[model samples]
Structures are given as structure tokens and as C-alpha cells.
Target: MGFREYRGSRQHTHAHFVLTGHTSFEDEPPLLEELGINFDHITQKTMTVLNPTKETDASILGDGDLAGPLVFCLMFGSCLLLGGKVHFGYIYGIGGIGCVSLWCLLNMMSLTGVSVWTVASILGYCLLPMVFLSGASIILSLQGVLGQILATLSVGWCSLSASKLFVSALAMHDQQLLVAYPCALLYGVFALLTIF
Candidate 1:
């Protein structure tokens, strides 16, 4: 269907006709006849529209609050299990915490029944940059440039993740937020396995 404006005393709008699936203007004789509109000798125009309020089932998959802290614990535990000695283990554990925390935050934001596009946009512009920075920090650390830089970056990612979690919590209602907590915890456990 398409919208058309009627030039009356007051502005009026209405849908003209429905377009059958994959049917071009040339094939829409019935639609043309019903609307008393001509399909021939008319230019076609394409327009894009975005609905910010549309939510999808995919948004319900994860939660952040429970996942964040659980992930923090698992990462720390894995570092110890790997026999990372002294400060080395602690550093690796902290890095894991940051990555997991961000993942949790993303999950939590999704549970609020918000628009999928908005959630995707936020993840792309915000969460992705942090992940990239943390990955780069890990690479630099492996290269033996400066250990402190890696630590700084890892902690920075965690801090940003935590901040996003808080924002998502405030934006969503209490009951909905509570429901997503379990999934977040599961995410944390799974994340730990992946890292180890």
C-alpha cells in the first residue's frame, strides 16, 4: 500500500492501493483500475521509511546485570586455572572481565523490548569500538610493547560496559529487567568456557 495526500480544505491522507508481492506497476492492472490511476506514463520514485518503535523477538535473547558480574568471576577463575602467575593471571582475568561485561550489557539492553534497529545501532557505534580497542590492546600486549597500556584498555572497556548497563537498567522497567538476568548469567558461564 502507498500513501497519498488529498488537497482539501484541510490536509487529508489515505492509502491508495496495495501492491501484490513482487508485482511491478506494469502488472498491477486491478490496482490501477480500482484507484482510477494510470500506471503508464508515470515516473516511479523510491522512498525509505524507518519506524523507531518496532521491536523484534531477537531483542529478548540476553540480559546484562547478572551476566556482567558472573563473567567477571569466570574470567578471573580461568586465569587462575591456566597457572598465570602473580600479576599476569590477574591481568588476564581483568581483561576477560571487561569483555564479558560488555557482552552482558548488550544482552541487558536487548531485553527491554526496545526497537531492534536502535539496539543494533547502539551496539555497532558503542559496544563495537570497545571490543576493537580491547582486541588491539591484547595484540599489543602479546607483542611486548607495554603491559600497562593493555591493562588500561581492558579496564576502560569494562568501565564503559558497566556504564552502558546502568543506562539500560534505568531506561527499562524493573520487572522486565529482572527476567533477563538469568540469561545474562548463562552468557557469562559460556563466555568463560570460550576464553579458557
Candidate 2:
């Protein structure tokens, strides 16, 4: 027997890649945008993760909020548990909270223009370091307080790097980093709690 079909329309010959898992930040908004407030543009931009000006808008974080981070966390957290940290979930959870907080703070501070997506972009990309911090905290546990600080520092440094790109994109004064550093520190504290 053969899998043959007589298609009456062009649609019958076409396959939806999304149904087969080829979907990415690039494809979700159009298909799932109707599902809710889809921020596809914002989410895709996060993949690049730079915002150098006030006009750098990252508010369109795509359709599924869980889409990007879930893949990242699963891989990182599983590695941590394999390395013997049974509390790996804490890393995943705290990283998520930090991104949400980043989004909220950017909106409140009036540092960004346009919609809330730009912050989403910044945090989404920044979370990559948080994943590393999770692994570092687990591996560096033998180093005590110094290792913990270093791991947290990695997360903070990541945020600062993103902030610098964001400042450049937004064309803001370099002094705006005074605001950026504390925000990054707050994100670091969230990551810090995971290790300690």
C-alpha cells in the first residue's frame, strides 16, 4: 500500500512546518498571535539581544512566553542535576523571575521607548548567562563564597553588556548605566539566590 491522496486544492499538498516542530521565534506570532497578545517581533529581536537607543523596542516578545526560555532552562538545569545539584529547578525558576522583573522595571523607569518588547528582548538574551551561572554555581560549589560571587558577577556582567548595547541603540547618555547597573545587580541577586 502507498500513501497517496488526491488533493483538490493546493493546500492539500502543503505541510505546516509548525506542526512538525520547525517553528521558532521567527514563525510563532502569525500562527499563535490570534491565541493571545503575541510579541513575535520582540521575541525574535531578543535572539539578537542588543538595544542601543531609546527607540530600541523589544516589546513584541512573541506568542508563547515559555517557548524560548523553556528550551534553554531544560538543557541547563538537566546538566546541573547531572553534575549533582539536586535543586536545579531553582536555577530555572529564578532566571525566569529575573527576566520578568527586568521587563517590568524597564517599563516603569521610562528608559525605553515604544512598547514593552525591548525589555523582553534584553532579558531573553541575557538569560543565556543565567544558564551558565546555574552551571557555574554547581561546579564551583567547592570554592565557597568567592565562587558564588563570581557566578553572580557573571549574570550581572551579562546584563551590563546588554545594557551597554541598549544604551547605544537608544542613544542615551553613558551615565544611564547608573540605572542599568542596579537593575543588573537586582537580576544578579535573583541568580545569586539560586546558588546560595
Candidate 3:
């Protein structure tokens, strides 16, 4: 995806939800038959650290080759620069996401079955909700304790939104919370920082 500065009227956005959904599937999700990721199950399986699926044809992390995470970085930076309501360093907006993303991508391997690419891609795709929440927090001009509270709540939303897919992609169950815990902390820190 290319990034273009909008000269037109900007109402702001859900292509994000669709795009994120694109990252979740190994092959063209039924909804996106025309222009969607064609996750190659055969190639992807060879790349994963673990495959809990009995079916070898299942879509794993490397199945799809779209660069959703890279697009997200640009979106985040752009939102911070454009949103205007966030009254802090632009680095805070952009860099906070990077930091949280890095932490999750790195620590996610502690679980039994996960791939670095999948973790990064999932977190990258997951950036949609986090960025939107931050944008909303800034756009609404939330601050002080109330701001912190709302920011933290947004983190919860990201965690919940991401958990289902993360669990599925990693083929984890029963102990999914173990995987989710790190995400909670990363979100907690970044979400609170948005208030400051």
C-alpha cells in the first residue's frame, strides 16, 4: 500500500479493519476474492516454528506476504502529525507504537508455538485499533487521570481484538492468556503514555 498525503476532505476511517483482516487469512479470505492476500499454505507451513493444525494446508504466518506492518508505521506517524490534538512530541505518538510493537514481537516467542514474522505482522495489523484509539484520545483532547483511564481502556480493546486472531494464527489454546499477558503490559504502558 502506498501512502499519499490527503489534499481532499479528511473524515478519517475502516479500510483498516479490512486490511487487518487481510493479514489474518492465509489465502484470499472469501470476502476479498478479487484483491486480497493469497496466503500460500504450502510455503508458509515450512516457515512456522510450530504447527498445531493437523491440516498441512492451513494458513500460517508466512502464508501471506503483504506488508501490513510497514503500512501501519506510516499510518501512525501520519495520524500523529495530522491529528493536531495530541499535545506532545510527535515522537511519542510514532515511537510509542514502535516500542510496543518491538516488545511484543520479541517477547512473543516465549509461548510454545509462534513465529517472529507472525507476531510482528499480527501486531502490525493490530496497530489499527491502537492508532485509532490514540487518535480518538487526542482528537477528543482527553487528558489527566481521565485521559489515562480511557487510554488504558483502549489498550484493553486492542488486547481483546487481537487475542482471537493471535490465538488462531499461533494455533494456541487453553493457555491463550499466557500469550496475551505480555500484550497487556505493552498496551498498558503505551496507552498510559498517550495521556501524557
Candidate 4:
């Protein structure tokens, strides 16, 4: 048998015992007696211990990988509410769907232990084509060369900002509060461009 003692404040004192062979609680008496320790006044009480094998379980969401999606959902949901009243149909529809999809992917990946960089790269691949398409559409919708250039730039900024948000969300699972921060800033700039 091996013994270790832990000292702390008066409220708690801990002792750890390591046994080399099988022994029962009843066998402790002789060992205690030999060690000049007494346990006559000690009382037995019920105690419960919780052990978790999976790191992604619901109980560990905030401390685990699930924090990424949880934060993304909240940020996107708030954006929807704010933009909804303004009748920004594109923001409410396509943007909302994209954010929700990203959130779902994050949740699934949390259980799978997929790397955040992989998630970000996949999202980039999916969004890159759309970025090109949106830019082309904005250019074609404009009347003059200058107008086409400005519109393309504006749409490109919006798309790039959205892509950055997805990347940020995937990379920083623990810091979800800023998941949509980049998107929101870009959205504000896009709104200003639309007004001008």
C-alpha cells in the first residue's frame, strides 16, 4: 500500500491511498491500526460521481466544440430579427439559411471531431462559386462601366465578408460571440452602398 496526503485550508483535508493488491474496506482496519491511525468516529455516507467519456456531450457544449454552432445561431438569429423589420429580403432569406446550415454543420462536426480548418475550407469552396456569380450579376445589372465596377466591388465585399464570418465561426469554437461580427460590419457597408 502507498499513502499520500493533501493539505489545504481547514475546510478540507484529502488522503489518497494506492493499493498494490486487492483489498476491501473491512481490511482497512488492520492497516490503519498498523499506521497508528484511528477511524472509529468516521461515518459512512452516500456519494455520487459523474464520469463522462465523450467530450462533445450536451453537458460540455460551452466547454467543448459545440460552442461554435451555438454562438453562430444566436448571432445570425439576432441579425435576422434586426434586418427583418427593414424588409431586407435577401438578408432574411439566403443569409439566414446559410447561417443556419453552418450552425448545423458545426454541431455535427463537434461530435465527429473534424478540424475547424477543414470546415472553413469546405465552406469556402461552397461559397466561392456564389461570390463569383453575385459579382457577375451585379456587373450585368449596372448601366455603365463605372456603375458595373462599383456594383461588382460592393457585391464582392458582401460575399467576402460572409465568407470571413464562416471561417471565423469555424476557427474559434470557444469564442462564438464574434461569429457574425465580420458579416454585420460588411452588411452595414453594403447597406450604405445601396443607399448611395
> Which one is best on TM-score?
3
Against the true structure, candidate 3 reaches a TM-score of: 0.53
Per residue, candidate 4 scores C-alpha lDDT tens digits across 8-70 of 675322332333332446655576456532232110000000111112222111121222323
Candidates' C-alpha lDDT: 0.36, 0.55, 0.54, 0.37
The C-alpha RMSD of each candidate to the native structure, in angstroms, is: 19.1, 9.0, 15.2, 21.5
lDDT tens string, model 2, 153-177? 6666666656754555454565567
Clashing pairs in model 3?
Answer: 26-39
Off by over 4 Å in 4: 1-87, 105-142, 172-196
lDDT of 1 by residue, 75-150 (tens): 4444434433233354445445644554555556545443333332232222222333334433343334354444
Lowest summed lDDT over 10 consecutive residues: which window, candidate 2?
55-64
**Residue runs of model 1 more than 4 Å from their true location after superposition:** 1-72, 85-145, 172-196
Model 3: residues with Cα > 4 Å off, grouped in runs: 1-66, 83-113
* Candidate number with greatest lDDT: 2
The weakest ten consecutive residues by lDDT in model 3 span: 46-55
